[model samples]
Every structure is written in structure tokens, then in C-alpha cells.
Target: MSEQIEDRNVARAGRLDTATLSDAMDRLGIVGQCRAIKPRDAGFRMAGRAFTILYGPAASPPGTVGDFIDDVPPGHVIVLDNGGRTDATVWGDIMTEIAHRRGIAGTVIDGINRDVHLCLSLGYPVFSRDNWMRTGKDRVQVEATNVPVNIGDVRVAPSDILRGDADGLVSIPRGHEERILAAAEEIEAAENAIRKAVAGGMRLDEARAQYRYHQLQTRAEGAKP
Candidate 1:
């Protein structure tokens, strides 16, 4: 059952954009949108299962910052929760190069990242609260891995589907992925039909009316579509 679900999630991750997924989440009353977290480059896009990491203040000796990259599986997103600290960076050029070479999907941070030029040049997606030159090496340490973490204001668990594009990133809970994907697919189809109608000379209002645009993301009782 778990395998089947994972497969479904992979399929959804490949096809859905963050906007549609956000709508689906809203319809389902799920708060998966990561506020204030955005791509280092607006052109960068990524989709993958999350490999979560939680961060905390460094101990007296100052623990390591990014050794976890070596163990992350390919196609898994590295979600770093740095407590929304923008003063220090949890990622940089070397990590970008390594993550790109390893086929890792991308990195999303609640803090900031330095050396973003490398990511832009290499096309390795890195999303964060902001970018800075300050190093997080001795300021923060890995608290845990494959653990539940907060990004923006959303709670993300290990293996949750993460989708990011020009707009921003959103985390879809694994358990609700199937339902969310279904609603997103429906919403996309409706929007497409509206677009088609508009292209075929129908008024924008008429097209939206025909497609019931306002209700596409309306929250339903019990989270039913």
C-alpha cells in the first residue's frame, strides 16, 4: 500500500505545479504553503520527495553544517529548517555543485543561502527565505534528519511531496497527496477549458462562468472535492 501511494505521489510531483497544488490544498483545508520562502532564481523549478533536516543553535564546540548531503538520495529535496534565520546561510556553492552532481532535486531553506550565483549558473534550484554572505557553519548545527520540520509556516514531514516553480514552493502531506492531486488535476482541466473558451472568442467572464471558476478551489465540507 505504501509503495502504491509513493508511486502516485511521484506521478503527481511530475505533473502538477505549485499553483494548482496550492489550490488543491486550500480545497482540502490543508496549510501546505510555505510563506516567504522563494527560489534563489525565479527561473528555477523543482519537484521531489522531501529529505527533511532540522537545525538549531550550534553547541559549544560548533557542530557541522552540511555533512548530510552525502547521504541524501537522488531526486529527494533537501529541506533545511534553520528557524527562519536570514543572517546566516545554510547552503552555498560547494553544496550546490555536489547536490547537482548527485542528482538531488533541490534545496529549500527556511534561512538563507550564500553563493547563489553557482546555483543560477548550474541550474541547480535552491529556494530559501533570502540570500546572504554570512556563513552558518559555526552558527547553526544539524539537529536531526528525516524529521518533521517547519518551512515558512508549514509543517513538512519526511517524504512529503515538494513542488516549486516561479511562484514559490508548497509541501503536500504524503497522506493527503492523492486527494490533493485529484483536485489539482480537476482544477487544471477547468482552467484549461476556460482558456480554450476564451481563445475561441468567448468573453472572459463567460468562460469563467461556464467553468465555475470561483468554485474550483472552494473548500468543501469534510474536505471533499
Candidate 2:
């Protein structure tokens, strides 16, 4: 993606919530919602490009887990894919402290996290399947970075836009960001119009009809919203 396009999409994405994005993906026939992945705190929210990390079972000799935080760019959310393992944690207090100090946007793990108190106290967002106390040091090892990985059942690629909130996380593919954002904006606008109409005493059915509410999330031909 061009720098200009990325900036534009990122800015637009910041204004959107996961609910709208998920509806947009549905309309576009894209599966972007990360199932079962939720924010640790209901009030936590984050939006940024993705810095992906893939983790796998540790080697027989127990290879190093990883020390990739130093390389993660500020304002990018660290996305860890541990194959949805919840027994051990790949993130901890020290990493949270450094990530917060470095201006990192947030962290999303398909597996789990430890030392969540640091995240809460620092006001840093950490979204994942769950939180556990066991460390993953010798249980798992970093397999790759900036590569495609699965979070829930969604595919997340490097640089993909991630918008996470109390609801959950949604990974917006870089190539489809523009279309997805446009669709979400349209959906939001329609919903707002419906709300306004209803508030003005119009019948709910009439308001929905005026906004084509039923068709708002219906998949269109050519997958164009």
C-alpha cells in the first residue's frame, strides 16, 4: 500500500468501532472478526497497524521464546499467534512496561497473557483469549514475524489494520481497508439516520424502510458494499 493510502485508511479506521467493522466485513463477504478474542478491560480501545508474531511449540532443546519488542514500531499493535494456546502466556509485565514506554499502541494475543496488572495500571490495552500466570518461556518459541497468522479463524497479515475495543478485535486486511471502511461508514450513517427518524416519532418500520436497514448488511454482487 502507498504511504498516502495507508495514512488515510488508518485515520478512518481510528474513528470506527469493531461492531461497524464487523458489519462492513459481512457486507463485503470478508471474515475479519477474531472470535473469542476480547479485551481485558471493557473500556479499553485501540487502533493501529499490526506487527505480527507467530509462536509455535518449543524445540526439543527448548529454543528461546523471543525478544522482538525492540523491533516493533511505535503505534503498531503487536499481534501474537500462539495457535490459541491458553495454558501458557507469551506476554508479561516487563514486556508491557517496555511496550507502553515505547509508545506501542497495544497487544493482541490469540493465546493468553500474564502480568495483566501492568497493562491495567499502565492503561495499555491487551486483548486475548484469556490471561494465565504460567510463563511460556520454554513452552513456546517464536516461529516468525510479520507473517500471516490466524487469530480466531481470521487471517491477519503484517500491516493489517486492527481496531479493538470492548467488544473484540477485528483485523482489516490492508488490501481491503478502503472498501471495508467505506462500507462501515455507510452502515453507521444509515443506522444514525434510523435512530434520528425514530427519535423524531416516526414509526420504527417506516424509519427502517427509509434507510433500507434490512439490506444494509446484505452481501452485494461483486462484493461491493
Candidate 3:
């Protein structure tokens, strides 16, 4: 996508309501769930600017991450694309400390991460495929930051809103931000009505029908009059 389109997507993501955001995530079927590596137990609060970190044997040369940090805005997330490798860690204690000191929001790795004790103690949010003790030396290197990278079968550009917690991570595309949020809001409203109906002694199936779930499906399917 064009940079302009990407920028607009980011702008829309900035306006997402937290509740609706969560709802959208729940409705979607595992679109952007960050693999393993539970987030710190400090409660789920979205932070981070926007940075994409890529790590792999085919990754770019060394010092790429440093250049990325110097270029990207502060509070950005470091999205690591390690080709889904869980053997070598892309980010560890030292990188975590450096990223935190740089005011970055968090790190999202498509590979594994290490130094769990230090990462947890330091309270830096991390989403990864696995947790390992082996470090990325000549095995993998920082390809680039703030560049386009693929994570979980999706192409993630810079500035995408990445929200994570004990549940997992959700990577929102820049373009679909507003539409997804709107759909999520509507879904929540429909679910709330159903919730109230069930509390009023309505049967589950009856409440669902009354809420027009079938009608919504028909409309979604472009049913004829």
C-alpha cells in the first residue's frame, strides 16, 4: 500500500475506542495474535510509537536496529520479523533495557525471546513466538526497523496499532482501522442488548434471534428482497 494510505490507517487506529478494539479482536479469528510470551502483568495498556524490527539469517546487516531507533519516532513499537524462528532469541535483556530507555512502547517478535526474568522485572511488554536462552549472534541479525515486515501471515508496515495483554497481541492494519472499529462497536452494542435480554429471562436462542443476528447475516450475504 502507498505510504499515504498507511498513514491514514494509522490515524484512524488512533481514534479506536478501547472497548470496541477489544470486541473487534474477539470477533476476528486469530488474525494477528502474537505467538507466545505473555505480556508483563502490569495490566493491558497500549503503549509504543512505531518501529518494525526484522531478524533472520537473511536479515539485513548489523547496526540496522540502531539506525532504526535513531530514525523512528519515540514510543514506537519494535515489531521483530524473525521468519517465525523460535530457536534463537531476537531480543534479550540488553535489547530490552535499551528499547525501554529509548521510550519505545513495546516489542513484538515473530520469533523467540530470552531473559524472561529481566524482561518481567523491568516491566517491558513483549510478544513473541517462544522463549529461549540462545542468543542471536551470527545466526540472526537486525535487518531493519521501521520497515515493512511480515508477521503471522500478514504484512505489517510501520505505525500500525499493536495492542497486547495476557490474552495476546492484535495487529490492526492501517487501512481497516476505522471500518473494523465501527463493526466492533456495532457488535458490542448487539451483544449488550443480548446480555440484557438474557438477564431478563429470555432464552439464549430467542435473544439471539430477537437481536437480528440472522438479518445481519442476510445483509452480509447480500440477500435479495
lDDT per residue, candidate 1, 65-159, as tens digits?
86888999998899999999988889999999999999999999999999978999999999999999999988999989999999999999999
Among these predictions, the greatest TM-score belongs to 2
- TM-score winner between 2 and 3, please give it: 2
What shift in Å separates residue 63 of candidate 2 from its native position after superposition? 1.7
Clashing pairs in 2: none
**Is 2 or 3 the stronger prediction by lDDT?**
2
Computed on alpha carbons, the lDDT of every model, listed in order, comes to: 0.91, 0.93, 0.65
User: What digit string (tens of lDDT, one per residue) describes model 3 on residues 1-225?
Assistant: 675655555444445544455556545432444445345444534544357877657344433323355555656777888899877777788877877787677787887888888767777787777788986775776766568888766677777777666666667766556655566667667878988999999999999998975443223333222
The clash count of every prediction, one per candidate, is 0, 0, 8
Candidate 3 segments whose C-alpha is farther than 4 A from its true place: 1-49, 58-72, 213-225
Record all residue pairs in model 1 with backbone atoms less than 3 Å apart, i.e. clashing. Answer: none
Error of 1 at 198 (Å): 1.2
Decoy 2 TM-score against native: 0.96
Q: Put down candidate 2 lDDT per residue, 1-225, tens digits, no spaces.
A: 688878788778889889999999999999999999999999899999999999999998887777999999998999999999999999999999999999999999999999988899999999999999999988999999899999988999999999999899999998889899999999999999999999999999999999999999889788743
Name the candidate, 1 or 2, with the larger lDDT value: 2
